[model samples]
Target: MNFSEMKDQVINGVKWYFNRNWNRDDVMNMDEISDEVHSTLKMNTRIIISMLTAYSFGSSVGFIFNYLFKVEQRFVLRLLVGITIGTGNLLYQAITTKDRREIYTGCLKYCVVIVFSIITFFLLETDTTLRMIVIHSVLILFMGYLVIYSQEILYNADFGDIDYVNCTFNVFFHFPGIMIHATRLYLQGEQQEEN
Candidate 1:
């Protein structure tokens, strides 16, 4: 083929290749689109890691607090608070429309905890001290999951007009309770396996 005709054919082939591979509109702005996708993914990943770290940390901290702070709640209740955060993180990870890796397991854990938290908080009527601790734990766990970690950060970030607190509160105030809630299930699973 003549040089000009060969060049024209090459151009057409390049365009076709790109068209098949990416949304035509996005193809031209691949960098921008990629940046957006990366940002979202990064946000999601950070929240997940934060949840994991916070739950683990809170469990230990809670155990210590029970002894050191003379906190009104029982040691077990504090531990339960940590488990609640972990479960909420897992559930948010699970139920989130974007990713399903942790969804099912997370949901199961969350539901169990929610039920337990409700019983502990209301049905049991254990004590004033225990009840407050339980309530605080539950509030932090799920609310933290919603506010921090992943979902709320991405969308619906507003938490009932409290001046849109930073992401830190999202995890601290809420997910710890989630970990506490999940701790029970984790124990149950281990017990079942042991049996």
Candidate 2:
């Protein structure tokens, strides 16, 4: 195929992949939904409590690690640990729910994030301008993904509900830890330059 045709095929493939239809058993007609399903659909208070507790605990651990432990140098390790904890929680939920599609997506997300985090470690020692460019590139890619593929990422396939709570959970859980590490790295770099 010619170059333009090949590019079009690739773009169409990606669009189709992201928008692939799911075959969730939970999608039933209103008349087909069992009374048990309706009865069991009360508000889940435990989810709210657990999320708050997890975020609080994660933030406290981040504060302690930054201030108490004095383990300031290995920023990548902190980020890796944070991502691991958050992703582990997601995987656990996917498994407990027995949703194969979500399990697959969660695993994919974990792998991609882990690989990106490892790559970030190598960039730590690079020159300032190069580092900034890489960071900005990552930011742009993330924002673009959010803008273009938000529906796939944020919606629940089975329920057609906007189920992005875990994303907020991960952000609250991971961002602080990573930010603390980033701040320490910046300060250390400044001190070294002064010396």
Candidate 3:
């Protein structure tokens, strides 16, 4: 293909990736729709609670480490700590929950978090500001895609059957470390500029 044709194809591919929808269109009665909405609200509430719990736990750990060490270059250490805590939490849930589906869903959600964490780690390792910004933008887009895909999967399954709380907890458990890393980078940049 010609250069222009290849460029057009790449642009179209990106557009398609961002715009693709995975919504279900099954016709249902008003009662069924109301029931679905109610169940969704309940599940969302549980998920929000799980996310808050994870965030609080992760933030506490991160704050303790920061307070104790007073070190700026503890991204790897924090990542390891987050992973340990997240894994322990997941294992605890898996042991307590009798449902195999819940266990599998939690595992899948944890895997997704790990994958994104690794990607962010590498992307943020770049020293150039412009490059980092570009990479972060792309990362945001990919994360948005992940959110859409995850919602599609969750909505398609029986909401009550999945342990969405634990799954969401697993997904958000690493967020504190990521936030810390980003803040560290920003502070370092500021210091460099000031110097």
Local accuracy of candidate 2 as per-residue lDDT tens digits, 1-195: 899999999999755533423122222111222333222221221243245445545654655655643434345255435444544554354335434345345545654665575467557755443443444354344432322222233223324343347544543344443344444555766787799
Evaluate all candidate structures by whole-model CA lDDT and list the values in order: 0.47, 0.42, 0.46
How does each model score on TM-score?
0.34, 0.27, 0.28
Q: How close is candidate 1 to the true structure, as a TM-score?
A: 0.34
Clashes (candidate 3): 0
lDDT of 3 by residue, 88-128 (tens): 44454434543434534554565566556656766777444
Off by over 4 Å in 1: 1-48, 55-112, 117-125, 128-152, 155-195
Off by over 4 Å in 3: 1-34, 45-128, 131-135, 156-159, 169-195
Give the better candidate number (2 or 3) by TM-score.
Answer: 3
- Using lDDT as the measure, the top candidate is 1
RMSD of 2: 18.6
Please give the lDDT score for candidate 2: 0.42
